[model samples]
Target chain A: MTDELRSRMVELLPRLRRFAVALTGDLDQGDDLVQETCMRALSRVDQWQPGTRLDSWMYRIAQNLWLDRMRAKKVRGVQVDVEAAEALAGPNGRRVVESRLTLDAVGAAMAYLPEDQRVLISLVCIDGLSYKEAAEVTQTPIGTVMSRLARARRELHARLEGHTREAIPRQQAPKPGRNT
Target chain B: MSDTPDEKTPAQPIGDDLIMPYADGVLAPDQRPAVREALARDPELMQRFEGFLFTRGPLARAFDAVLAAPIPERLLEAVRGPTPQRTRPTVSLLGSVRLARLAEMFRVPDFSPAVAVPAVLVGLAAGWLAHYAIGIAVPVDSRGVVDTASLQRALEVTPTGGSAKIARGLSLAPRFTFATDQQVWCRQYALIYGDGLEAGGMACRAPDGVWQVLMSTPPVPGVRAQGPRPAGEGPGGNTPPNNENVLDGVRSLFKQGDVLGREKEADVIKDRWKTP
Candidate 1:
């Protein structure tokens, strides 16, 4: 039974890693967080009753760990290495840089949010957990989850569109936030 | 109505409470028509809804790169416990503890007390070293049982959706409180140790008013024999299981009573869990 659980956890690595990366907004730190979460989970494998969603369990662990790190102020600020991103742009430098900038812009905007909102965005928007599922993971009420997520999306849309306007001339930018 | 000019009529504005869910396609079917109608009538509302929709794809795809990257070997080793050879006491007694503390901090389950004692010593010593080096108090003890004074305070006063610092390196966040079938008040919480270790469990308030730990999920034995499998051997990773939700395990412990709300929980905290 334990062996089967371990294999299932191994299978869960990719998605877990993705969730971690999105939460931390850094590859190295995210993987470190993931490692710690796995170790923590493996240690408590017995507590994990069979017939429960391992992914949700692991996500809760990761979220709690991240929140702890945040509370400790141990997490470094979100740093996007523009040089590293540019270096990856080989043949299609312009397109790659553009997309990379968009991603970085989104990351930056997400970073500006409070940690709770950032967590909701990662769980519901990025990882595709339903509002109810996110609430369960965070131990928040479903209404609180929806309201927070809604606010997060609104802020993210504003920030990203604001970023786009800064990149392009204001006149050329689409007027999404403008009132008719 | 006739007094208002046709061109100056205000467009009906959709609240985020409604439009955002509609944009995410999760809105209830009955509630969708109003939002859709507003979107159709108000170009501005449609534009705002589109803005919410636009960020979804980019945010979803932002971290896709990590998925394609290879899983790190250290992580694999973490899940697969210490290798068999490392458990053998070929090295000096202290050396094994050092290795255990360094490579497998919480993973040395099979270690006998002879090894476990020294490991604790090394952990304490390392905790002190880390304390001085990093200037933050490192907690040597990682038990999640709610025995400490600070933990007790948190369990008593800290309401659900709240957290409290139990020690320099340990924090407690209570998830929720419920009444068991026996009418005992039990609360679920997660503890984050300074060393990046997290423990979660449920504690029920005993008749004596002490929060007796009903269950704390500390590390258990198993996975020591398992080794890393090839990366692609399993099905695509990260598929969420269709089994019961994680919290379901604790459900049977409690009755069908509604989980205490914030105000009611506050009252319970104030009354010290005494029966009214």
Candidate 2:
């Protein structure tokens, strides 16, 4: 990797880690996502332009990696190591458990949203992407991004308030729901 | 979280629906003056506005720990391996400024107490702690009891003297902090001057991260209650008024040196609220 690319990657680990956590729901998966994104970025160096928003590119990669992981998870049972998550949490596992409760409430709330809404929020709401940048990353219209974001926020508010109930899942799914 | 609306102009009356746009920063610049004006006088609307702000930040706060965590060795090796083998520069992944900003994002849950503090308490209403039939600064439910939610919110999130006019327009001042026998952090505070009520209490952060009001008393009557004694007071007020009746039947706990400075208390709170 070039020196400039290496420096930017270092600078973006925090942002990338943040996006991964939001996308993957916890730090264990988030770590995998960041690692995968970095590996992909470094291996396919020519795919990125020098002066572009490298953070957004990395975010898109992490999102794509997370999506791929969710697909693969369908073949096998969902496995999130409880002890590993706790260990990752250090003295506190906000990154691993993320929620004060047994699971991550923000992720649980985000699971109530459609994929597009989740992507919109991960981009614009948490990652500080502009409307245009979010639209570009998600490849959606700006108006759609804005409206979907509103709906997502509204649904999230409701779910967070326990006003919305998650559909009982027959089998494990990636979308956040009652784990047990 | 910033509760105040646009600072460009004062608040003006506006529809509740306008709160999202204002909070999302998409509100038209010209339209902000009226919305800003409205959010000021309307505590209810102001709270709703703050709710919108809270929604925007939960994801960040939820995963904030990742920002501070050392990257997995696999990822670091992945980066180092790709580059020509040179000594890697020890660049802090997140600068101190960014780290502090990330830490600052942890806010007490707004709008949803149950969602915010999900462990060990169901909304932590503390209906059982309603024995103190004393005057209160914050409004009370029908039982004439002070609900712990509003007071706990003030204790958990708002810094000393920095509360917005929330829930009953009461001005709460965090007086001191200590750890319970269970190692749960607790804070002592005064109701100060709100709704003609003068009271003080200790709130401990239960394992679930909710501040449980341990004791609520209206300061000793005739013994001359000591005001908040910061470090300079020399611990003269260490002994809470030596009046039995003032204890209000609530056991007085916490030894001296138990209380801490407002800044230290905030640090403990941040630690208690640490991610995971």
Task: Compare the candidates by TM-score and give the number of the best one.
Answer: 1
Which lDDT tens digits does candidate 2 get at residues B217-251? 44223232554445212225344432222221121
- Tens-digit lDDT string for candidate 2 (A1-180): 374465457546766877877776667777787888899988888999876888878777777777677667745764442332233232432223333422366765565455567777788777778778998887678767766776667666544544344333213323532211
Clashing pairs in 1: A43-B219
Reference A-B contact fraction recovered by candidate 1: 0.56
Residue A150, model 1, lDDT:
77
Q: Work out how many backbone clashes candidate 2 has.
A: 10
lDDT of 2 at B246: 25
Off by over 4 Å in 2: A72-103, A163-180, B1-19, B33-50, B82-84, B87-276
Candidate 1's residue-wise lDDT over B26-50, tens digit each? 7778777768888898887887787
Model 1, position A117, has a per-residue lDDT of 80
